[model samples]
Target: MNLEARKIEFVQEFLKLQSEEAISRLEKILRNEKKMSENRLVEPMTQDELNNRIDQLESDFQNNRFKSSAELLAKYE
Candidate 1:
Protein backbone atom coordinates (compact mmCIF):
# COMPACT_ATOMS: atom_id res chain seq x y z
CA MET A 1 0.00 0.00 0.00
CA ASN A 2 2.80 2.38 0.94
CA LEU A 3 5.92 3.16 -1.11
CA GLU A 4 8.29 0.92 0.86
CA ALA A 5 5.81 -1.96 0.84
CA ARG A 6 5.30 -1.54 -2.90
CA LYS A 7 9.07 -1.64 -3.42
CA ILE A 8 9.31 -4.79 -1.32
CA GLU A 9 6.49 -6.41 -3.25
CA PHE A 10 8.19 -5.47 -6.50
CA VAL A 11 11.46 -7.00 -5.30
CA GLN A 12 9.68 -10.21 -4.26
CA GLU A 13 7.90 -10.48 -7.58
CA PHE A 14 11.10 -9.67 -9.45
CA LEU A 15 12.97 -12.38 -7.57
CA LYS A 16 10.27 -14.88 -8.50
CA LEU A 17 10.41 -14.04 -12.22
CA GLN A 18 11.44 -17.16 -14.16
CA SER A 19 10.73 -16.29 -17.78
CA GLU A 20 13.63 -15.25 -20.02
CA GLU A 21 11.68 -12.22 -21.25
CA ALA A 22 10.95 -11.15 -17.70
CA ILE A 23 14.63 -11.50 -16.80
CA SER A 24 15.67 -9.52 -19.83
CA ARG A 25 13.25 -6.74 -18.98
CA LEU A 26 14.49 -6.72 -15.39
CA GLU A 27 18.11 -6.58 -16.53
CA LYS A 28 17.36 -3.61 -18.78
CA ILE A 29 15.56 -1.84 -15.97
CA LEU A 30 18.48 -2.49 -13.59
CA ARG A 31 21.05 -1.31 -16.12
CA ASN A 32 19.13 1.92 -16.78
CA GLU A 33 18.67 2.48 -13.07
CA LYS A 34 22.41 2.05 -12.53
CA LYS A 35 23.18 4.49 -15.33
CA MET A 36 20.82 7.06 -13.78
CA SER A 37 22.36 6.52 -10.36
CA GLU A 38 25.86 6.94 -11.79
CA ASN A 39 24.84 10.24 -13.34
CA ARG A 40 23.83 11.42 -9.87
CA LEU A 41 27.42 10.73 -8.77
CA VAL A 42 29.22 13.89 -9.77
CA GLU A 43 32.73 13.99 -11.26
CA PRO A 44 35.04 16.94 -10.68
CA MET A 45 35.64 19.30 -13.63
CA THR A 46 39.23 18.90 -14.82
CA GLN A 47 38.89 21.36 -17.73
CA ASP A 48 39.50 25.04 -17.07
CA GLU A 49 37.60 26.13 -20.20
CA LEU A 50 34.52 24.26 -19.14
CA ASN A 51 34.78 25.86 -15.70
CA ASN A 52 35.01 29.33 -17.27
CA ARG A 53 31.82 28.75 -19.24
CA ILE A 54 30.05 27.90 -15.97
CA ASP A 55 31.50 31.08 -14.47
CA GLN A 56 30.19 33.07 -17.45
CA LEU A 57 26.72 31.68 -16.89
CA GLU A 58 26.94 32.77 -13.28
CA SER A 59 27.99 36.27 -14.36
CA ASP A 60 25.16 36.45 -16.92
CA PHE A 61 22.61 35.45 -14.29
CA GLN A 62 23.93 38.16 -11.99
CA ASN A 63 23.57 40.68 -14.84
CA ASN A 64 19.89 39.67 -15.49
CA ARG A 65 20.45 38.75 -19.18
CA PHE A 66 20.53 34.94 -18.94
CA LYS A 67 18.08 33.03 -21.13
CA SER A 68 15.52 30.63 -19.73
CA SER A 69 16.32 26.88 -19.60
CA ALA A 70 14.11 26.28 -22.66
CA GLU A 71 15.76 29.06 -24.69
CA LEU A 72 19.28 28.01 -23.74
CA LEU A 73 18.47 24.39 -24.67
CA ALA A 74 16.95 25.34 -28.06
CA LYS A 75 20.21 26.89 -29.30
CA TYR A 76 21.85 23.44 -29.41
CA GLU A 77 19.46 22.41 -32.16
Candidate 2:
Protein backbone atom coordinates (compact mmCIF):
# COMPACT_ATOMS: atom_id res chain seq x y z
CA MET A 1 0.00 0.00 0.00
CA ASN A 2 0.95 3.66 -0.28
CA LEU A 3 2.37 5.78 2.57
CA GLU A 4 -0.97 7.26 3.63
CA ALA A 5 -2.65 3.88 3.63
CA ARG A 6 0.20 2.34 5.63
CA LYS A 7 0.03 5.16 8.18
CA ILE A 8 -3.72 4.75 8.59
CA GLU A 9 -3.34 1.01 9.06
CA PHE A 10 -0.59 1.55 11.59
CA VAL A 11 -2.76 3.99 13.51
CA GLN A 12 -5.60 1.49 13.54
CA GLU A 13 -3.32 -1.17 14.95
CA PHE A 14 -1.93 1.26 17.49
CA LEU A 15 -5.40 2.15 18.70
CA LYS A 16 -6.04 -1.50 19.58
CA LEU A 17 -2.93 -1.71 21.80
CA GLN A 18 -3.74 -2.66 25.42
CA SER A 19 -0.32 -2.78 27.04
CA GLU A 20 0.97 0.41 28.61
CA GLU A 21 4.56 -0.71 28.18
CA ALA A 22 4.04 -1.32 24.46
CA ILE A 23 2.47 2.15 24.07
CA SER A 24 5.36 3.74 25.92
CA ARG A 25 7.85 1.92 23.67
CA LEU A 26 6.00 3.07 20.55
CA GLU A 27 5.97 6.65 21.87
CA LYS A 28 9.71 6.51 22.46
CA ILE A 29 10.29 5.11 18.97
CA LEU A 30 8.17 7.88 17.44
CA ARG A 31 10.07 10.55 19.40
CA ASN A 32 13.46 9.15 18.31
CA GLU A 33 12.36 8.90 14.67
CA LYS A 34 11.12 12.51 14.75
CA LYS A 35 14.43 13.70 16.28
CA MET A 36 16.42 11.84 13.62
CA SER A 37 14.33 13.37 10.83
CA GLU A 38 14.79 16.87 12.29
CA ASN A 39 18.55 16.38 12.47
CA ARG A 40 18.63 15.28 8.81
CA LEU A 41 16.79 18.45 7.73
CA VAL A 42 19.85 20.67 8.27
CA GLU A 43 21.28 21.73 4.87
CA PRO A 44 25.00 22.22 4.28
CA MET A 45 26.27 25.79 3.73
CA THR A 46 27.25 26.67 0.13
CA GLN A 47 30.70 27.99 -0.80
CA ASP A 48 29.44 31.56 -1.17
CA GLU A 49 27.69 31.37 2.19
CA LEU A 50 30.85 30.02 3.79
CA ASN A 51 32.93 32.80 2.24
CA ASN A 52 30.51 35.42 3.50
CA ARG A 53 30.71 33.95 6.98
CA ILE A 54 34.50 34.03 6.88
CA ASP A 55 34.45 37.67 5.78
CA GLN A 56 32.09 38.54 8.61
CA LEU A 57 34.36 36.78 11.10
CA GLU A 58 37.39 38.70 9.79
CA SER A 59 35.52 41.97 10.09
CA ASP A 60 34.47 41.17 13.62
CA PHE A 61 38.06 40.32 14.57
CA GLN A 62 39.44 43.54 12.98
CA ASN A 63 36.87 45.61 14.87
CA ASN A 64 37.63 43.87 18.18
CA ARG A 65 34.01 42.76 18.42
CA PHE A 66 34.81 39.43 19.98
CA LYS A 67 35.60 38.07 23.41
CA SER A 68 38.76 36.29 24.47
CA SER A 69 38.81 32.59 25.45
CA ALA A 70 39.47 33.53 29.09
CA GLU A 71 36.57 36.01 29.08
CA LEU A 72 34.21 33.40 27.63
CA LEU A 73 35.31 30.75 30.11
CA ALA A 74 34.94 33.16 33.01
CA LYS A 75 31.23 33.68 32.12
CA TYR A 76 30.47 30.02 32.82
CA GLU A 77 32.34 29.91 36.05
Best by TM-score: 2
Candidate 2 local lDDT, 3-74, one digit each (tens): 999999999999999999999999999999999999999999999999999999999999999999999999
**Tens-digit lDDT track for model 1 on 1-77?**
99999999998998898899989988999999999999989787779978998899889999997788899889997
Task: Tell me how many clashing residue pairs each candidate has.
Answer: 0, 0
Provide the TM-score for each candidate, comma-separated.
0.49, 0.58
Superposition error at 40 for model 1 (Å): 2.2
Global Cα lDDT for candidate 2: 0.99
- Which 10-residue window in model 1 sums to the lowest lDDT? 42-51
Off by over 4 Å in 2: 45-77
